[model samples]
Target: MTTSAMETAVEVEQRYGFDLIDLETVRYGLIEIAREMNDTLTRGSFSPLARDIRDCTSAVHMRTENGWEMLASHEGCVQHAFTSPHIVNFTMSEWDESTLREGDVILVNDPWRGAIHFSDLNVLQPIFVDGRLEFVLHSTSHVADLGGPIPGGFANGAQTTFEEQLKIPPTLLYAGGVAVRPVFNHLLENNRTPNLLLGDVRALAGSLSVGASRLNSLFERYGLGHVRASGEYAMDLAEAAMRRGIATVPDGDYVITDSLDEDAIVAEEITLQMTLKVRGDSMEIDYSGSSRQPAGNVGTAWIESTRAIIGTKFILDPASPVNSGTLRPIEALLPPGSIVCVLPPSSCSSHTETGSRVVNMMTQALSEAMGARGIACDTGTSGVAVIGGVDERPGHEGSPWGSFAVPGGGWGGTWTSDGVSACIVSIAANCRSAVNEHVERESPLVIWEHELMPDSAGAGMHRGGAGAIFTIGAVSTTVITITGDRSRSGAPGSSGGGRGMPFYGWLLRGDGSGSTLDPRRAIGAEPLFGVFDENGEPDPDKGTFGLGTTYMGGKVSQLVLQPGDGIRLIVGGGGGWGDPLERDTERVLTDIDDGLVSESFAHAAYGVVLDASGAVDEDATAMRRRDLARLRDQNKWSVPTACPPAWNTATIMEVAS
Candidate 1:
């Protein structure tokens, strides 16, 4: 690919030969249509994942000579909406015009055919105008339970795709404006929560129906030729804008390697390597050096490449519209069977876990390439907790209930300001965090504790957001699955900034034994203050317990929690930007007043001295900062290394002792 392939704004205008005002009007109209589709889905949804958490995404794709390309999308679950074109193209290729028609809805979730994972059920409806198929409306939602060993499809212990759950190919979920009884019945029977599946599937179909009607209105208002030409012009404009963004970066080859703590089934770490090559106005991402498909379900298919595109958009040109043209100047080379591009039989139930890792890696590489315009790394995990069991609530006794909670982590700091606290991951655009009251109402559980962990953010001139502590207690026996990451290593900071704290999880016993179960311990569970002292520092006597070889809680499957038992999570904070010593003293005082930064952390990390009056001591603080800077300049102090957990069992025990 070359810059010549992209045209200038003037050239695009001349080629399309359409009124600029009309094009802009059509573009906004399409955006309105997409937003309407999104509103329809969420309003009509039944499951909390769709209704409350807003885990679903909707988009509009138009037919092109090469294939289908996205026109406009509801800005939620960015990966899902951006990747819809691939699945639409694939399905259209598999079944021609004979199989697809007006008033018909197609369903598919095969990762090989372009899907985020098995749990993301895709519903596509083909739009026909004047006897020609012109567009496809898409809606995707994470269905609750799809008949697997575990209730939710994020199976951390699965070794094969079959173990993940039922894989639905492109099938006619609704044909000719009517439901396919056999297909619908079979899908409902295969799921643990039939009511949820029934309602969610209908909701997706309903959203598509609304989109079709609105699209017809768009074409009717502006004749077919103008509408079609306007969409093409919109895409061309986006491509040119994207090319301009890429042209700003200094051309070079940037490389980065990172690892997940472990594939739940294997204690060994899973390494991911990437080499980004920039030439002129084009970029190429080569992931041929990543680890082979692991025994667990963390491996993903080709859809993982989209994360690289997403990274490009977020880092370089976030304001640019998301369309097929924005991806024209970028290319990704993913080796088959690698963690990023898994082959057949390899499970992908935990694709989101590894997918987020890819996004983080891309951020690190792109930020290094862009220099001052770069942003620090955010908490690299989505922090998804899936809990399922029978509902004992009044009027719903014996019915199965599932809770998909996304208590997202803190965001990394930018050049100008601190990161946002408890925000959703980068890939999940516009998705909301799970509400505690809603979760409790839907299930037999209590959210006992949910708050920001003070002094958790990385220290810098502009610090990262504070991480959070979440504790959920079960009212009865229930199955839990946690697919998260960033425990072995924290989110790496850029330049001289400090890395954030790692994630920690524990299962507290309700048997009055005061025993806590760490993921790394199979027996002899003991309660310990895993990562904090009286003043929020690492206890010299007690090393971090749920980390490295002693921690395997990042990914767990089918773990049972009894009545009165609770699950606690100390979510990791984001990486900081700039040097800690350079931070404003007044800002540090404000952080102290807000309880975001502790007095000890200010003294230790920032070299700031506070007097008994809770005010900065000018002379002592200046001296302390000078001494700390001298030590750092002489290489006597160094930032913590974000490395993999590769210790042996004996070494882990020695560290614990």
Candidate 2:
């Protein structure tokens, strides 16, 4: 802060009988408290999704004249950063603030009321000091199962939300420091894994108690008014920082359009368009020209705004504190009933599929507007695979088991550095991929291969990160449901760079042969599901009943796998930032040595020539690059404005072939 500003802050602190130094202490103290709450939830949770992958969010909110305002949120899922506010706002609007009491916890999972899907449950606790409401603690986590026809909550073939799973609005799970038996028992009866779900809920609730205790300690040390004002001041600072960041971008409208491979129910393409409008110190994200809701599970609501703020922070003001104030400068214009903002009865079990694409679209538009201070697109898929079945292990026969794996992909390249390889998707802030050991221990599946793909990254001056390949073999009969995108069209590159390869899935047969998955089918046909022949044997050309094998797509339904059968997922690479031929020869050689790029790709995409000794032939490389440039100009090779990367000479697909 400036000297004059510091003086004013001191005066304000004196007027409130607070210390100016305590503002910074209280600011960081709230964040530390949030982290403690997150650690408590993760340590106490039972589900692997929460305990292992940490697919949950924790935050501390202070009550303001404008309702609950986010003060401190741990680095976690960008989707859930705003879910707390949405739930708090909904709860206060439904019931008067005076109706809320200490030791009472509100539970909700309705997507329209701040949840991403039915699988994610949110718990809210109101913290009262001296019988006056001062703050609220919020936590959310994904559970193993919520009694639906499908094993996991993601019912890819479902046409409506009712088919997805149970929907719980804001209801009291705890009242007067006691568990609400009816509400507690109702959730258990509806979930397949009742024991685990109960444990997770208790963990979330327990974490809130932990937060309440810690926050109370802070209030006990520094007066409640000073502590509360510190949180509000933190938010005000974030708002100012965000506004300054927005002002840095040139005033104009930046727009980009992205698409999903298919809605898991049908083969129709689902498209989403996003526009970033910046003027002065404020911005507006408009999701107006998006496709209508489809008859499938890949839909999202409220999360559109969440992804917008995430995108803005990631590209411009990532250092600012994530609170209501940081989101104050941005206005989100989401057309109701659009894919980005679905209405009632629309299934959103796999909303992350669309939510990830929203962030990618925003990144592309904002990066383009920022010129050199930008990055290309990432793999753009959550790369989530839900596998479940009956446990046939010793002493656990007939028991149900499920595994949720997020085999993350590559990140986009930037002007100064190459993208990160084999990392979690961009939308997930601190999520991790499922470890091979954990996957094997949780389910009856053995991970066979987990390696980086060669020649997968988009070629450029700084190449995009390479993706990964994950293959697993089923020891017992297993059913798998995969949700992903960027199958047909890979992550798009920028500034004349080559596009990254697209994602693909394959069914490994008993005979060691593989059948490619069609990136348009929800699932294979019935009777055999395109995995077995008419005689119930693995067929090279087709599955049972003469139905073509490999009919399932990126977003698939229940595909049964026999023993010795396996599935492989090839996550696409991130997009490059600049021209491929302009890449340094040594970097190209380094990529080849590191097994990220093939020797053929170096020659084809980077136009780099290596002699017999595996060293760069400098003179020949310069001539080759010149010739490649001439050919590119003659062929009018340019990145498409509105389409995905093509399988032509400009992409990495050529070298792969």
User: Which of the numbered candidates is closest to the native, going by highest lDDT?
Assistant: 1
Indicate which candidate wins on TM-score.
1
Per-residue alpha-carbon lDDT of candidate 2 for residues 1-657, written as tens digits (9 for 90 to 100): 211224576675765456768888999999888888889888998878778888888999888888888999875565677566887777656756777888999888888887778888889898988998778899998888888876667788888877878888889999977999999889888876787888999999998999999999998998888897788778878888888788899999988988887886776678899888999989999999999888787878787776767778877887866888888888899899889888888888888778778878877887888888778888888778888888777776887877887777888888889988887777786877766797787678888777787767877787788888777788888888878877656788766666676666666655543422322221221221222333333221223211333544577778888877888777778888888888889988988899777677678778889999999999999998888788788994443211111112121112122
lDDT of 1 by residue, 1-657 (tens): 222344565664566666667777998788788889988988888888788878888888889886998888886678886687788888878877766778999999999998878888999999988989889888898888888888868987888988878898999999899999999989988888899889999999999999999999999999788778777776766777788888888899999999887788877779999998999888999997899988888888978777777778877777867877787888889999899998988888887778778888888888899886677778888878889998666687888888887777777777889888877677885787778898888789988677776666777778888777677788878898888887656677776777776776655667633233222221222222233222222321234534333345478677788888877776667888888888899899998899777787788777789999999997899999899899999998754322111211222233344
Local distance difference test, candidate 1? 0.77
What overall lDDT goes with each candidate model?
0.77, 0.76
**What CA RMSD would you report for each candidate?**
4.6, 5.9
- RMSD to the native, candidate 1? 4.6
> Lowest summed lDDT over 10 consecutive residues: which window, candidate 2?
640-649
Off by over 4 Å in 1: 1-13, 393-395, 511-553, 639-657
RMSD of 2: 5.9
How much is 52 displaced in model 1, in angstroms? Answer: 1.3
